[model samples]
Target: MLIFLDYFLLFFHIALTAFNALGWAFERTRKAHLILILLTLASWTVLSPYFGWGYCPFTDWHWQVKRALGEGPLPGSFIKYCLDGCTGWDSDPVTVTYYTAVIGVVVFLLSCGVNWRAWRKSHHTQSSEIA
Candidate 1:
């Protein structure tokens, strides 16, 4: 059961990371995606600093699972950890945070722009139809 929980958290972490980074490409999922992004930003920016500035609850939870299962030290970010595992690139936590923040902001802005354009286009179409 503990092993299963560990893997589940790992996969869940990966999915959420990817969704935050790329989910904006899908029109149908953008609304929920943006909300999740906002929640993530708030947690990282406004929450208590016990876990540090860019603390991720999911990562903290996963670390608990690892500790319970007697696993070794966990990585800073899931994506960076995976990259290190696959490509053997030793990246520091600070670099991981920098890359993650940049990517997150870019993806978020792109998502908002896409949603805004769609909203404007629909509004214009409706106004034209009424005239």
Candidate 2:
């Protein structure tokens, strides 16, 4: 189970990261495309728990296994925090707030950089024409 989760996360992250990265690679994304990227990030974060997410969801899933099998770090006779959502850790609200913020800023910056370059070129052309 843990191995499977890890594989899933890796594949999803790589694909989505590449999707957004390449979209911004050639040029700055238009307002609509930028919004779509933001939405994708938000969707990943908000549905992370249900979808299994983060830089290492597999690690977390393994932790649960160790706890159940009576391993270290968990420090308990039994029970695990691995499946928080299913095991009643839902009260704490498993929100991916941090990643959402990080991704949002990153996406926004890329958008700004692209727009800035385009604007600068336009301005230079206009100035040259006037001269």
Candidate 3:
């Protein structure tokens, strides 16, 4: 149940980021676009690795969360269990990285879409005045 909940939250957060980025892209300057690009990368790292749930059986920070909730530290064996889920010896690191890159790319493309929409709208308004 906890596992399901954790992944659910992770997906939802990513979705929200995509949505917010789209909205902001509408009115951002070039600098803002750069900032958004960097942020999307940062989020990918955090959400996909030790800090996030990207490739581990348990998220890298799951132990911390469990500890903070008065559950105490997870047993070493349990930690291994979670890590195994995310990165088993049989798992291909290349594959994992590919998935991570894909996520980042998807967000980046969405940002571009927002910017294009805004651009087109502005272009339309300007052209209408010449007609």
Candidate 4:
């Protein structure tokens, strides 16, 4: 069960990370993307005081499972873990964190811009019709 959960979380977290990065590109997912990205940022920043910076609940849960399975010490960054696992390159955690942060901020801003434009366009259309 724990092994299954570990694999499930690995897949789910990767899928979620991909979505958080690219979901805004699709019109149907823009709002959800914005919300998710904001929530991610909040987790990293707003929840940092208690959980420490760059905290992710999913990662925490996964790490717990890993510890239960007797895995050795893990990197602080999940992105680094994925990269190292997938590419066989031991990435620097600080560098991974920096890139992760920059990418997150970029995606968040892009999501906001696209969502705002969509909302404004719809609002304008409604106003024009009402007028």
- TM-score leader: 4
Regions of candidate 4 where Cα sits further than 4 Å from its true position: none
Model 1 error, position 51 (Å): 2.7
Better of 1 and 3 by lDDT: 1
Better of 2 and 4 by TM-score: 4
Judged by whole-model lDDT over C-alpha atoms, candidate 1 comes out at 0.83
lDDT of prediction 2? 0.53
The regions of model 1 sitting more than 4 angstroms off are none
Q: Tell me the tens digit of each residue's lDDT in model 3 across 39-114.
A: 6566556555554433333333555455555654443323243335567544444564565567557657766766
lDDT of 1 by residue, 16-77 (tens): 98899888899898888888888887777777466677778888888788889887777767
Per-model TM-score versus the true fold: 0.89, 0.37, 0.39, 0.98
Against the unseen true structure, what C-alpha lDDT does each candidate score? 0.83, 0.53, 0.53, 0.95
Off-target runs (Cα >4 Å) in candidate 2 are: 1-22, 28-32, 35-95
Between candidates 1 and 3, the TM-score winner: 1
Q: Write down the worst ten-residue block by lDDT for model 3.
A: 74-83
- Per-residue CA lDDT of model 2 for 1-131, tens digit only, reads 65665456546555655556556655544555566576665555676677644323433554565556555654111112333424665322233344444655687688667767777999999999999
